[model samples]
Target: MAEPAGGPPRAGLVSVVIPARNAEATIAVQLDALYRQTYPGPWEAVVVDNGSSDGTRAVLRSWQRRMPQLRPVSAPEASGANHARNIGCRLASGELVLCCDADDIVAPGWMAAMVETLRTSPAAGGALERRSLNGTVALAARPPKESDSLLDTFGFLPYPAGANCGFHKELWRRLGGFDESYRYGSDDVEFFWRAQLAGYELGFSPHAVVHYRLRDGPLAIARQLYCYGRSHPRLYRDFRAYGMPRSRIGEAVRAWWRLLVHAGDLAATPERRSAWLAGLALRAGRVAGSVRHRRPYL
Candidate 1:
């Protein structure tokens, strides 16, 4: 957990590390948002470019020239975002680490809010509230205000979305960062569970907000759901091993029921409904892929 050489001291707070892959379209917007942060604290934006074949490198270079705080690190392998994030964490010098995806947009006050909350609390990791881009809904159930303990926050822990989270650098190192063996999903779940078991404090910050973009079309939505479903078994196994709550069966059933109910909404429109059904088919395909390639978490 010592600061890497040639960088600032470990006391520096909140390094924002973004792991990006083929994000040429939105990386600039995210970088610009980072530049506009009002935190005024010691921070750095580490962009781990994960073998992006797209013009993502060009975008990062342009941003780097404009902002000295923006540091670009190349990750030539296509191992996935988790690997890129590990590389970023290793290179980062801040005492605390914040992660953001390239496609998402962080509010101007987001960084300052989380940092302040973490500094005041004894939590190892802090959660930020998330709202969808289309203004559809909040991503997770809001936690009650009176709860001061991590156990009271356990229900909200499962709600910890990867994009809006912050953690202490020492705790992150102790937890071994992210498990790279996970190829497509559940890396966040695995890491958070490990952190909780290690007695690391977890807290929530509703003021820190991020806008997450929804999947583009029906095909994309279905693919995402299917991948999520396939990853559930492994997540359940991990949760069980860590003595954490397991909701795999319940989640799977609810997802199926929701899909059935929403089937009518999508089918109500002839043109768009077909696209929705196609997306469902893609989800099914991903589920099949997951089953075929299922790997034991242990």
Candidate 2:
């Protein structure tokens, strides 16, 4: 890496591509956080709306004066974040592209940290924190584990969450962007895995933090985890040829057995009940996914 005189490392215009759909409630907070960034380089935020049926567009319109660097566009033709992200990345006129969710808040030095990290690495993932945005119930349902520098998936190469990751624009073009077929979950996982298979190194930056929002309530948590569970088999099916390991039957049996043992425990606390519902939903989804994707993961 080269630096000019006493200045920081060389960096170009960074386009922060955000994919949004009906994010009228939380987008403003994320946008406000972006506005308060401490990165000294030139950057712009291109928010692609994926068929928002609410006041999402209206909210973006209202923020024009407040954030002149903000560029709001439409990708209503597609129905997923991957599609919206592809459109936004294509339209972004920057050397680097940093992606974040419309609902999460980024740290003040996030951009700077990411920029610094990418100077040496081709792709990088930012750390995620849950306590800032989630309450005890949400946290209880999905307890926060300390995040690893790289995320492990089914014994395959580690990858990053799409909510906080970035890469050079050339790499995006080379990889053909994210696969839209993964409409719900594991889009990020698949993309980063493909990148690694294509010979690009994926890195992580703890300094670049994102306050991640969790799905609250048992219903919401169950639904989200179910979707996640469904995606796992699909991922396994797609990557197993490349040496991705299969789920252990012994582990799966123990999981279900434990759930069965506690099935009639009406005296369980709300937090414990929430965990039970999440576990049941995820297992059911894995079974459904095994049938749907023709790959047995559970």
Candidate 3:
């Protein structure tokens, strides 16, 4: 578990895989941040264009001139971020692979921290900061504070957020990559959980921070949270045999009751209204997901 050793061959090459889809507006910023990384190690950005019909390819073409290590590939066979990640990782030519989202910006020295952590840990995830890229509305809509440690889902195994995670190339092949079927959220959660169940240790690197982006508007935030909630039921259904905890009916009832108690907040400030909408949407999604996935989660 040491840093990639110096050698004539591609010994220490770190491949940063990014999955992009119609991210023309934000991807350039992400690529700019990647170009400014202070890792000081040999790293390549393997950007997989996931069927973007916009000017994303144009943006990538422009950055290619600025970033010599930027290699853009197309992944039209599949439609999800996980699918693009799988495609990008398969084509990556590096000992270590780091996966990040196209919409988020990595902090300077982020790569260095992740590589430094991977020197001792099998797989690692970084801290996500919401304050940097988000405004008051987006921040208020999603109030959960980012954790320095890997997230523990449903009282189950700790898993890394897909946006800022790194692992060895061999481990990715062994785990058969991410589940492409997970078109929604929690793909990273499922992957890391499976990795731990298969005997690999997942670690946290607080110094490797990624400035995570929140959805722009109330509707966008609702959709994201609903998709996340819907995905959790599917996760529960798949991992319950491995002792994944189930959602409690009492808790669900209490959650609804609390929402009702705070119904007045919907008419208050924009921040309060956003928070109320987000809470209601998430719970509704969980209920809908339970029915869709045939698992009584809520």
What does the lDDT read for residue 122 in candidate 1? Answer: 31
Can you write out model 2's per-residue Cα lDDT over 157-245, one digit (the tens) per residue? 98888999999888988999889999878889999999999999988999999999988687898898898899989999999999889
lDDT for 212 in candidate 1 is 63
Candidate order (TM-score): 3, 2, 1
Write down the lDDT that model 1 would get: 0.66
**Candidate 2, lDDT over the whole model:** 0.87
The per-model lDDT (C-alpha) reads 0.66, 0.87, 0.87
Which residue pairs in candidate 3 have backbone atoms (N, alpha carbon, C) closer than 3 angstroms, thus clashing? none
Models 1 onward score TM values of 0.78, 0.94, 0.94
lDDT of 3 at 93: 84
lDDT of 3 by residue, 63-92 (tens): 888899988898787899889888878888
Ten-residue stretch with the least lDDT total in model 2: 1-10
Query: Compared with the true structure, what per-residue lDDT tens digits does model 1 show for residues 1-298?
Result: 1123335437955788898889999889888888999997889988888888899998888887899888888887657778988888888888888888898888788898778767854333333333445322111112123222222222424434567777777777877878887656666767777776777657677666766665555545555655654665566555555554544446545656766777775646543464445446534644564466563221
> Candidate 2 versus the native: TM-score?
0.94
Q: Model 1 off-target regions past 4 Å? A: 1-9, 121-132, 135-159, 244-266, 270-298
